[model samples]
Target chain A: MSTIPHDAPAVIDARGLNKVFRDFWGRPKVRAVQDLTLEVRSGEVFGLLGPNGSGKSTTIKMLLGLLYPTSGELRVLGGSPRDAATRERLGYMPEESYLYKYLTAQETLEFYASLGGLRSRRRRQRVDEMIELVGLASARHRRVGEFSKGMARRVGFAQALIHDPDVLLLDEPTSGLDPIGCRQVKDLILDLARRGKTILVCSHYLADMQDVCDRVAILLDGRVCAQGPVRELVRQPDTWRITLEGVDDALRDRLVAYLQEQCGRPVAVEPAGRSLESLFVDVVTRQRAASPPP
Target chain B: MNLPRLVAIVRLTLRDAVRSRVVVSLLAALLLVLVGLPLLVQSDGTPAGRLRIILEYALAAAIGLLSAATLWAGCATVAAELQDRRLFIVLAKPVHRWEIWLGKWLGIVVMDAAALAVTGLVVAALVAVIRPAGGADSQFEALLSARDTFHPDWAAAGLVRAVPAAAGDTRQFEPKSVALLPGHSLDFTFPVSATAPGGPMELRARLGSARPNRAPFASLWEFGPPGKPVSVVTSTNAPGLSMALAVPAAAWSPGGVHVRLTNPVGRDPATLVLGTGVGGVELLVPRDGFAVNLTRGLLVVFARLAFLAALGVTAGCLLSLPVAVFVSIFVLVLIASAGYVQTVAVTGMYYIPLESEAPELGWLDRVVLGVFRIMNVATAPLIRLEPVALLADGRRVAWAIVAEAGLLLGLAYSAVASLFGLWFFTRREVGRAGTE
Candidate 1:
């Protein structure tokens, strides 16, 4: 979990959380969240990983009080989600990047800042800071309606951080972003975590989760299937590999036989090296390094 | 709880609306309908007449159009923002749900009011410019024309002559003598001479009516002024006809001769004065007329607009945009048609067959009719109270506006609640990354 000390109070705590939705015909349609038990400690980047329709969005919605759970004990900043006072300590960036299309990037930030009860002077400062922080300063005057999806997502991130809340819940923060934009968002999440903000990030990009998250909870069919530190979850045991060049056929056969005798199972030999895809990625990375920055 | 914050939210909402092209387009359309239509249809006539017609049409159109626009704008205020999830960002903050609701509601109300005022002023200005310049002069000319045809002509003249015939003759006069006598005239004396000789012969006298076929005739003396009275003789041969050989002294006058028709029958006869000095003649006939005073029409239009504004606001609160507009317009149409329907029904022009007596309408229709009684009600008082009604009417319009404000505030509260809920709900750990 990124070496976070366990003694800190969990920024988010929930027990026995459940949410049920009914269809238009008044029949129970789906259980979007079920018996979810989780804790997000302070100063950690937590990722929620799931496939489509896996209750990732639903759990996020319930956390934000956009939808009520069927039954649960949940707390953010040690208070009810529906409570206004509790909301002051939280910020959320929805999965869809919902924003007023008529407002410019700056206006959007200012509006959210106002809602956060920030005073005018401080709101202006915070707006500028956020715009620059999200790398939207150059396009701050452009209406959100004219912005690209990635740019709009950046504005969404800016609004979520306008109030500088204690916790940030971002749903699919980098869903539609290009590589550079995704990296920027990942870097922002890391920066926010480093500044002692607790963040719950929901994304489908497992590589992104592996790169940035201190821990992750994988959801399937409205329930978390597994959750822990990414490295620990994917850790392997008793697996060894050796690479050698110019080995004779007799030496290869002897090595294989020796290993097979040493272990109770069949010892197999294959190419011992980095994956081709990884090598290719490294080659592209080096090629890009050869070029000047745009 | 935070009034300033709420105000800020409201300000932002109004700003957003002002910047929205949809609202701008709708407002522009409303303004065009209010101002342009009246000017286009305005008749080239006296200011009062033009005003009367334009005010009537413009007021109706403005009230309908503006109310609809405003109500529609109101319906979209919350539902659209929520649908787009833009509300989610705002609600995620520390704002209250009620504040959001109130802010959105206020934004819509302000927009509607702006539209209403612009349209109302346009109609009012049209009315002001069209009001008749002089009220009494117009009324006097109308009355004079109404009284002209009823006055009768009082000057007319006719001559009378008498002829004498011989006694024992069956004919009152020979055909040759009848030709020498004057045409029909009022007979003041009876003729006694007929054959150039005085004799006490009874005269068979006939009075001709105005026409020749069936005329009333009177025997008269041939001597003296055409219309002067003379003695009449009963004999047919007398040169100067005399009645009892005496003539009344007062019958003759210097200026003109007097003529009178004495009815032999005892029944009273009707007479029309035919002399220049005729007096005390009166003519009466039934007449039909219609008039529209522009000032009164203006007052009525204003009253209707006020009523409609209230109704539109109320409808906005109760239903979504499309439904609210439909229902409100239907109500307006029904109300406008009530008078025409009632008039046709009262006059037996309605042809519905009745199997049984129709049930009387209850209090709801009564109240609607009472409030919108366009024809018979005292419209001035209502017009005078337009300002007060807008502010104080307890009906849905006023209450809807109030409730809308409340709803906006409620939205703000819900927004904040939603944010908190999202944060709380998402923070939980389902279990490991894939195997709960």
Candidate 2:
């Protein structure tokens, strides 16, 4: 992984990719992906945004080589996604945990590590690191069957990263996680991107995409409806929001009147506040700090 | 190709089998078959009968139970995981699809090996403990030791081409065709160059009389060389008879041991017909111990399980759980009923035509016969492995037969099944995330 140049070619590249699922008679039933041209650059965090049944999971499966496109080109790590070497450098977390119920958390990670071609010592080390990173150390020895949905998700996340893959295609990474786990995952994604790891995340959570994505492609019905940097895609030049600090009631009223006269319309003013996610995290952090687990 | 990945999948599969209590269930079933079967079967008071009960009924029941358990486990290990969506995690790794197939096979084989070893030891111990206390000693010995059957080489002895000149019969003295006249006698010899258990040798014979009544007749046997023959008298009326003769060791010549059957002038001219081929005459020579022979039989059974495991896994790889189980059971039944298939294959017919003396075939019979023919081509070698019968009858389960089973069932059949399985599994679209 380290041998690759920092300015390497795009890790994920697809052009006019189409996937048409067929019925028993081979007649096209659903065009799950159509004319989907997208590029995810090296060291960048990319997001696939769409609503339910909007080809998000389908596109992710294609990128992971779980499905083949009906037509056009698709590549990951400058080679076909179906290539074993390309898959070796990739990590995938599916929508569900899909873990072996009989294996403990540590065993699951170790199993994945072995599949990643790690030797005995390195596999053990990686398993330990992954369990610790996922905050599953305390429950590492417990079978995954006994874990809650959130814990299973955590284990899933750990397994995906146990190989320290250079690229990750995570579908609904935070679906079953609590706010804390979600925050930790988002932070971990950012940290991984900072270390030059290319990540492609598929999620319906707008805030999560906004927080970590350097670039995003929003799809609808198997086509990319929008693509660009997060700011560029969401920005509206005609509208603006300004937050003022330490402004009194009189100053605020005068400023709003001046803006209304200058714009030739009535101006609206509201206090800028922290997002609900941030507030919840703050409350949870403080409470946990007040009475930490022994 | 990837050793670690293969090992991991196999380990995980074994863990699943253990955690799901499949291993426990199989052990319990094997225990029930081994312990409960003796009580289920009423053994005759004779030691030979009791030993036959153990070797035939108990061992067969154990094999049947274990075979079912093996097939069920093989099917469930793969099919259940696929249905439960647990395979996605492993498939998502950098492992080949064939590795998964091979791994599941290895796990099932290991489980079967352990189960067979434990159950076989238990049955063997039970057989030893319940052995009758010193009665019908020869029959008991026959059941415990493997004996090689030797028949007279008639062609080598130049008897098949000979014509009895005294009666002026030009026909050859072939078995079942030859009729010894009242004044004439027939001579037969078998080479006993090999060591026989230093005791009286047993001769199994089937003699038919030309008389319409098939009345009881007295026959005289002269054992040893022509110069010095030991005489014995025995009455024969049935098609099959067993006669034990004690002759001095010195009586056996370097050429072979010779025995002559003569009929003194009876009430009417009596005729004797010898059985054709080896069936007419045989010498049973004890070869090995019962324990070793039992182990060889178990090895053959294990080879059969290997083939069954491959079959179940292949079915599971391609079909749903219920369908796979049904198909596997169907295959098991077909294999167990191989004797019927063999009959059909050889006779080239299925239903015997009652209207005619010979078997006649209809169109449907032809189709069924064709199917049986193809099945026999694929399964004849496996079908010939009658381990339970061999063990009960104290016949040697030769290493050559074991090797043949390993080659045909263990290697060839398993390889074919694995190829099909890997192909289906690799092409299978695992896109459905939900469990079936």
Candidate 3:
């Protein structure tokens, strides 16, 4: 994917999309998504956040063409996702690892790569790169059926990236991963976005979304309750946060008294603290480095 | 359209079958039917009868077992994948739905071909073991050779007329059989190849009496040139007796094989009626070897398998695993019993109707019978492909018959099935209609 401007064109666009699942007799059973309109710009990370049965997964499925919209339009790469040619430039990692139990991790990647239109030499090269990228080098030959949930998710992630697709629809990217794996995945999302790849992440991990997503749409009860850039949506206009260094306790008490006299309201000042995620990442990194896993 | 994609699906299907033990189970079951059945089953104490047992019973059993396996594999290949949700990832890739359907079909067809080849080899070996000790004996010649038979020219012999002679002549002679008077003589002529080597040939006929008691009857026969005739007399009390008599191949003159029959005036003379159908009144001349005929028989069976594979795969495209298998077996049963369907369609019954004189059908019977009649028309060609029966009788499985089966069963029917399957599956929502 080539580098693009900050305002890159929307690669995944949906307008007033509605998905109403029907029962066996054709009566509407559940309206999973309603007026679900969103756009994922190229070279950006877009997160779809919602709770269970809140239409997050359903919307992702419609974007991937696994489920058709009941009304309105949905397009990926400026074409119908149902088209084979359009899917060639798309990758998807489902929430659950739906892998062939009979195949090795390496074979799984090969199968997807081949279906993704890779030739023999290119397919081999990509399969190798993906296996290595997912840290499955040692388990490349092991049957995916024998893998743990975390390992299977890694395989799923590798398969999605095997074709070097320009757009990735990843559902619950860090659902089954450890802290390190989660951090690694969040870093990969950032890295992919830097390389001008469009990514649509669907998950309930609010902190993970805050770390990686540039824009987000929050769905509740089959409708988009809120949407915008993360900064714009989370910013509080009436408040300001300031971090200061080298201030003595006596001087800080005097400054707090002056602010309280100026505003005629209670004033509080506190030292800024590092986020727990950063601390966890630091502890894990140093421990792994010191142990040098065998 | 994409070759690599199709190859990938086919490879995946093969691996699934192998890992799931489906292929191994099928091979073991086929071996039991092919090798074990021949050794354990009892046959009439003759080389020909033993060979018949192997060709007819054992080979048919092998075909039956393989057919079931092919159908099961075809269904499971798609239905199981869909039910398990493995197709979610694959379908999310740039693969067309037809590629998935066709690739699975090709995989099953390859497995079927390999199994059938194994079955053919084992059956051939068994037949070789049961061959007569002295290769020059009559049983050896009859069992190992494909003989061509020629029937009587009843029309030329004035025994049967091609058209109705007078109005209301409802004597049932249109299908052609003659009732010879007590002492009256009837001349029968069988046209032979004239160049069909001059050796000993056999004459076979289904004989019966027209009397109410169906009493015993005797007949005198003379074969060869009218000048120097070889005479033989044969008798039997069983009505509709299947008789095989030896005739010297030299009896085939430039004109043809000529035979005359007479009812010896007092030799329990009852009016005799002879069948003019196949093997009714004919001379058998050894033409080819049994090996070639066996291969032709196998080809016919392969054609049959192709149709069945198409049927199973198509059924799997729409139904779940259990339901797909049920539909496949149901269709297979109906197709296998096409001949029976035809008979019942005509008589409106399989059993004899008791006190009411004849069977009658209600509305459901009428509709069902109508549907079966239509199916009979469509499956007529399939029913005619009787390879096992022909092979057992040492009759020639002609190349023309094989070509017909290949076109009708293997090509036309399979193409139609594949077209419908691909169309239906391409439109079907892959994420729907599964166990989930």
Candidate 4:
């Protein structure tokens, strides 16, 4: 609930970022990322929200230095993402689940751990811890190829955390997950943030981001349309709703005018109030609260 | 340099590759052929010959299949992972792109090399076991002592009787009058000859011993006008004639006469006389003159496999899996068929023997030949450097193997680069919620 310090240096920093893709004939085909700038400070969960083809993944790729930006100054952990030292402190989970089908959950973590420069003993230990952390300890010996979508996602999460990275860049971490899996991922993100890890999450699930992320950036047409603290941006100003039974048009108009005069803002009348999702949440909450303890 | 890290990466790559059913199946198939072929070819001939045949066929099959598998495996190992976005997790780590590429290539090379070594050893052992029992000396002697005699259609006439001894003499005999076919020639210059007052004798002679003796000889009579009457005479110690004489016009016959012989030192000498009817003259010829060059065959196979594999890997890197495989296999077949096509076309040219004279096809033929010539020039370098050419000789096979390994590594690196480039371009952020 506490606010992140504004003075803290951003773990990820980008300025005037641009990525242009050219066809085989050397002509520009798509301006995947335009001049864009953004920052994410330490110990904060910054979400990059966008629809498909909105350059969210492109921006993330550039930030990770998997791709060289057409023109941009981007840094991770105060160093170039392409730099080994910088990369060692960073973790990434792509939008697609890409675990080696032949590798078991433990092996996947171990392989990644080795790449991150962990010694054998340390790698084994870290892999174990990661498997437990991602709640994949029971299935650590199972090949990733045999895993379901949700299980593969868990393995991916385990690999990302295997190195104990300072910065975590996850692309659709909760995608193709069951409700329980989604909740677990959300909790994991929150837990990592609590551990003072800087997390950059790109996902289409706005509601999930609203619940877990401290701040969110909405990208549109290769540019950020809106970005700020989720709570602050979503807060409605002087907005009120009332439900009336069998209300006539004249009474509604009169009541609207009176409310506007009193509040100095428009008052809307509706036939109902609660959103279906909110009702569902309330029902689930009540059921959980009423259930007997195990 | 992080040796442990590199080793770990290589181990991981190999482990991952082994788990791929495609790789496992291909390797299994190769092993099956390698083991099965020798057993099947065990009965063909001596262990060496059978081994040679089996090894030749097995190596050919292995090279083709393994090359294809290695190329496909190399591309699929990295490219598929990237396509499926699985590589992001590994790339996300602290590993360098080059290291990833190197590790994958090492894994492929290790697996392929292991397979090749096993197959090669099996072939060598089989060949050793099946080789012919005789040593080189015996084989060589057998080759050299083969007869130089020739078969004749007509049966020789009359009995060849050994004459009995006459006082202090060994033996003597005479040949009866023999008719000759027109336009035919005969040479007769014995070690000792004398006319016996039958008919005007036709003497024809030349220089050289009758047998293949190392000594030289001189002619007794000069070749002269046909049908001239001259009594034939030769020294008792004169050498055998080396020349043939034609019976230009007349067919003179002598009633059976004795050909007397005596030693130059006044000792008795053995003599034999033979009779013959009309006959045609012909020279005896040897038939077994050609030898097989095994090295050439081996070299051709090696070069073909290496070239095909290289192109396959290149194509795989440049195109998608299915298209690359198809195109590479097609090119391999095309190249192999090219030799035969060239032979046929050249034979056709010889058959006609005058392309320029055929007005209707002159330009077309010229253009075709020109294209073929250009192709020959372009392919000459490839042919010279082909794996087989490099490895044809026993001494060079080692170097050829090394070069082939280098080529495979190069192709693998190129494929990784291409896949990485593609992955880099297509990757993008879909939403903010998934970021760390």
lDDT of each: 0.59, 0.81, 0.82, 0.60
Docking class of 1: acceptable
**Per-residue alpha-carbon lDDT of model 3 for A126-167, expressed as tens digits?**
998988888999999999999999999999999899889999
Q: Which one wins on TM-score?
A: 2
Model 2 residue B240 lDDT? 41
Q: What is the TM-score of chain A in candidate 1?
A: 0.83
Which residue segments of model 4 deviate by more than 4 Å?
A239-294, B35-48, B128-319, B323-436
Where's the lowest-lDDT run of ten residues in candidate 2 chain A? A1-10
Q: What is the TM-score of each candidate against the true structure?
A: 0.60, 0.91, 0.91, 0.62
DockQ of 3: 0.71
Predicted candidate 2 versus true structure: per-residue lDDT over B103-125, tens digit per residue: 88888888888888987798778
Candidate 4: deviation at residue A127, Å?
Answer: 0.1
TM-score of chain A, every prediction, order shown: 0.83, 0.95, 0.94, 0.84
Model 1's TM-score against the true structure: 0.60
Q: Write the per-residue lDDT of candidate 4 for residues B319-383, one digit (tens) a residue.
A: 55566557656655655555644553454341354555744547777677666665554344344
Chain B TM-scores, listed for every candidate in order, come to 0.38, 0.88, 0.89, 0.45
* Candidate 3: docking tier: medium
Minimum summed lDDT over a 10-residue window in model 3 chain A is located at: A1-10
Residues B87-176 of candidate 3: C-alpha lDDT, one tens digit per residue: 888888888888888889888888888888888888888877766666746765675667666888776678665355689655535465
Which CAPRI level is candidate 2? medium
